[model samples]
Target: MRKIIHVDMDAFFAQVEMRDNPHLQGKAIVVGGNPEERGVVATCSYEARKYGIHSAMPCRTAKQLCPYVQFVRPRFEVYKSVSTQIGEIFKRYTDKVEFLSLDEAFLDVTENKKNMASATYIAREIKSAIWNELYLTGSAGVSYNKFLAKVASDYEKPNGLTVITPDKTQALLDHLPIGKFFLVGKVTAEELKKIGVHYGRDLRNLELSYLVSVFKKRGYLLYDFARGIDEREVECSRVRKSIGAETTFNEDLPLNSEAARQVLKALAEEVSMRVKGRGVWGKNLTLKVKFSDFSQITRSMMTSYPIVEAKDILIYVEQLLNKVDNLDEKVRLLGITLSHLLTDEERLQENISLFEYMESLR
Candidate 1:
């Protein structure tokens, strides 16, 4: 059995805001995009949870739920620092750490220093360390596989711990709601209910072949999950396939030769740090320009080999800039993308996408 532990930070972004500005603690606070416009809530505090406000909900509706709620913009810098701190804590446990996002990650401590044997202990220690180092609590779920480990984490909220032992799998899964299982996302859960499979027991009793007939390819996956039999490894998912960052200014930027270069340089540096930070290399560089009127155009190029180094990416970005017409006018935003990719010609020649030839990573 693989020793997998899923660590999820509790209300990560909201918690950070609360920590930095203690005045927000114990109040209904939300950190995300604008509410009056087409904005949505990224995260909310426990206090906001009282009003049924959750992440990704339209900010307008969230305001309807709690008019007094405090809304704050996202602080990526602060969150990144906290994420790094949390990652350091995971490294203390094991090197086989797979970060799912800023808030969640998986750690395989099968050959831990202490040979702790129990994944539960590893989860507890990790959660404790997060609180100690970052002044925040994290929920942990430990199990023999990634499926159960992730499910265990969501069983509780805000500083909770749960374990799924091999022997206890059957009984534990029996009563668990189908909605709570991994891969059975919101849409799938509703679909399952329509099919009369509301719990693990219902799905487990389902014939694999019959499921295959109804859900087709996904049926095979449902069958495996029903029995708590997951073969998926704690994949050290790539830092990010491609890194691109964009910003919308409060005002439009002029389209002078110097202004364009200045904007392009800034965007290039920002995107460079994103992709280069992960040590990812790509052959294709794409530039996106959003005009003040919201008209967008993208220019792309394919290099002979991948450009992992930041300077190479920036140079390619500078070259691609020549493709855009300067007389167009002031721009609202500029964006850059470094693709872990190959040219279309290369793909046709190889008869497959770069991913397939690279490995079965996809």
Candidate 2:
């Protein structure tokens, strides 16, 4: 059996803020944008969660929920630096680390550098190191596969560790809520509930054919997960196929209006930041628009050269926007996606910045 450990930082962004400013500890705080500007909550402290605050919640709503809750702008660079430190700690035990995000990762320590026999022990030591060395706490889960390990890690939170051994897997899963199953989102959970599948035991009682008929492609994974069967590997180097950022507006704006253009520019900046952060570049730019009626359309352009900067991305975005026939439509959402990605290694061959390439064109 493979030994996997999933580590997730506890309210990572908020925790980091609290760590830096001692007065913020044990108080309700969030890391995000301004409430008046339709900004969303990126993460909230545990105390803030008591007031029904959560990630992706609008800052205005979070404020309404807890009027005194503190809001701080995101410091992504600082978070990345801390994440690098945490990654170094992971490398001390295992090189088979798969980062899901800056705040969470899965480590396959089946054959670890530390030669630790117990996966649980390794997880405990990792948690301790993060707390003692970094002044931050993390939750860890140990199991034989990625699914269970991830689930176990979430079972407890804000500095807790749980282990799912072979013998205890079935019992724990059988009682697990269907909504709690990995990959089962809100809509899927409601659908399963309608079919009398409220728990893993209920899910397992149904025939595979029935699930497939109901959920189509997703049914297969649900059936396997219900029975504690996952064959996925802990990929050390997972390739991200695309990087994108989007925003949904509180009020719709005319598609061709200046306000829409500004939103698009903001999205381009975000996409550019994320792409550069990953040390990759893209050759394709896709513009996604959702109208007031909830109808959506996407326009894509493939370029001969790498697109890396906000200015370059916006140039293509303007072209894509102009291509749309319904420029007068009121749009509720705008998104930008960069695909046909080239990794850091592949990018070295070109060895030229997008700015320099643009200058050559000039």
Candidate 3:
């Protein structure tokens, strides 16, 4: 067996709160809301889900569906801390653990504690440890590879565990919808359905040559996944590509110079904080402006030296203000993004010091 395991926490945030506070048990607990506001749900406890409420639904609509739902705002700092503890647990099983998100990860234990025997055993121990230590439950899926492992893990949810042996692979795949395949998203799934390609079995019957001819680049991917073949690996760690920030306005702007400059300065400050906090510097600055009518535009400029300060980010923002003036349109949202990253060695050679870096570059 290839020995891959996918572990995903069950209602991560809401479960953590329920575990810590006993009184909240057996009640409908939601982890994101302001009750009367327009924000959507982040995650809801299984109790709230009993009323058909799920994550990302509008809070108002969720409340309407389950009127007795107890709304609680998300506490991200707590979630981050809990995620770290869970990551430590996975590290004990294998060094080749890849975190897909705070609540889920994939582990390649081919050369690990179990060592070619049974992958399901390691997954069971990990799930047991999480329940015993953190007072939360998680689901596990074991298979020959990452793709099948992930599919198996979600097959049985909420403290459930499922395994897809090599023998059962074809049978398990026969009934799975094309949409259930990881990369077959909403748009592609609709396209597949239109052509009567609803299940993996249907896709497997279609030859790769014809699929590629019709779909071009994506056709090959469809053929590969249809056979339950995935060449992807688990990357446990990597650097962040970019640091940026965006904020949507409660009302549209009047498109005056005063309004544009004021909004740019505020957005630049938000971007600067993110860049500096990450301790990374950027060489390119891009401004994303969304109009009241939902049209979007982006303009970018490259700086000679990298910047990680509020003052310099504002300078680029000032430069963009002039570029956007001719649009003659009302503004609804403003965002600033920092990209074109530089490594630490490059930063040291360029002499990009913290003190003189911001203002001197201008």
Q: TM-score: which candidate is best?
A: 2
What candidate 1 gets wrong by more than 4 Å, as runs, is: 239-362
Model 3 lDDT per residue over 1-362, tens place: 46899998998888888887789888898876465744456688999999999865667778999998988866656776788899899988789988765688899988885464678888899999998888889999998888898898889889989998878888778789888997787768898889899999998999999889987977887787778787778887643577676667788875555766665665565565445434457989998888998988888899867887667988887787678764567788788899976655668867746546666778
lDDT of 1 by residue, 4-111 (tens): 999988888889999999999999988865677435566899999999998656677788999999999777667767888888888887888887767888888888
| Model 3 bad stretches (over 4 Å) | 114-116, 213-217, 238-362
Off by over 4 Å in 2: 213-216, 243-285, 289-296, 302-319, 329-362
> What is the overall TM-score of model 2 with all chains considered together?
0.81
lDDT by residue for model 2 (145-250), tens: 9999998999999798999998998899999999889879877899889979899999999999988998897789888998899988988877678988888899
Could you give me the TM-score of model 3 versus the true structure?
0.71
Error of 3 at 213 (Å): 5.1
Top lDDT prediction, candidate number: 2
- What's each prediction's TM-score? 0.68, 0.81, 0.71
Query: How would the candidate models be sorted by TM-score, starting from the highest?
Result: 2, 3, 1
Q: Could you tell me the TM-score of candidate 1?
A: 0.68
Clashing pairs in 2: none
lDDT of 3 at 328: 67
Which 10-residue window of candidate 3 scores lowest in summed lDDT? 270-279
